[model samples]
Target: MPQMAPLYWLYLFIFFLLTLLLFFMVNYFIKPFDNISSVSHDTKIIYKSWKL
Candidate 1:
């Protein structure tokens, strides 16, 4: 098998880092929406308790 060059390894590393960054960015954006939905659901439950 042919050995890969150092530049190719650098490119791979950069690609991996970018992939990780993109994953975190998506997670960050999504996490707030999830939290908001959960918070709203919890508040509904709390309101029901207050009415009881």
Candidate 2:
């Protein structure tokens, strides 16, 4: 059991790292779409302001 401790810890660390990587990847992919939608909304607002 003592010999397995390090391997167990390593697995836990790797799992944590993988979770963080996936979280970042999800956020990274989502942000671009959010930004694009916001940009379009902003452009529409600007056009409306110009019309007013």
Candidate 3:
């Protein structure tokens, strides 16, 4: 392979970091049902507090 310049190294590093972040984000959203339950619970609590 030809020698890589400074810009190429920077681009490679950024691409790698973004892929890692994407993996974490996908893992979080992969289970939408769990998130829905937790979100609903928070909403219910807020609504109950408002009634007081």
Candidate 4:
């Protein structure tokens, strides 16, 4: 029925959060962006300022 010290819990919580963040950064963002869109259609940009 005893409680923990405030600083102890705070430090542990912060450490756990930083560990989780590092795990995610090592998992997801360390890879290149994969091109999932397989569309081969042509895309054009027309200048509206030159149009009559």
lDDT of all predictions, in order shown? 0.80, 0.84, 0.82, 0.72
Superposed by TM-score, candidate 3 places the C-alpha of residue 17 at a distance from the truth, in angstroms, of 0.8
**How are the candidates ranked when ordered by TM-score, highest leading?**
2, 1, 3, 4
Predicted candidate 1 versus true structure: per-residue lDDT over 1-52, tens digit per residue:
2476877889999999999999999987776666667867776644455674
TM-score for all predictions?
0.57, 0.62, 0.48, 0.48
Where in model 2 is the C-alpha error above 4 Å?
A: 32-52
Better of 3 and 4 by TM-score: 3
lDDT of 3 by residue, 1-52 (tens): 4576777999999999999999999988788677668977776644465675
- Candidate 1 residues lying further than 4 Å off, grouped into runs, are 1-4, 32-52
lDDT (Cα, 0-100) at 29 in candidate 2: 72
Q: For model 1, how many clashes?
A: 0
Whole-model alpha-carbon lDDT for candidate 4: 0.72
The ten-residue window of minimal lDDT in model 2 covers 43-52
Candidate 3: list runs displaced more than 4 Å. Answer: 1-4, 32-52
Off by over 4 Å in 4: 1-4, 30-52
- Which lDDT tens digits does candidate 4 get at residues 1-52? 2356877889999999999999998978666444333233234445689778
Give me the candidate number with maximum TM-score.
2
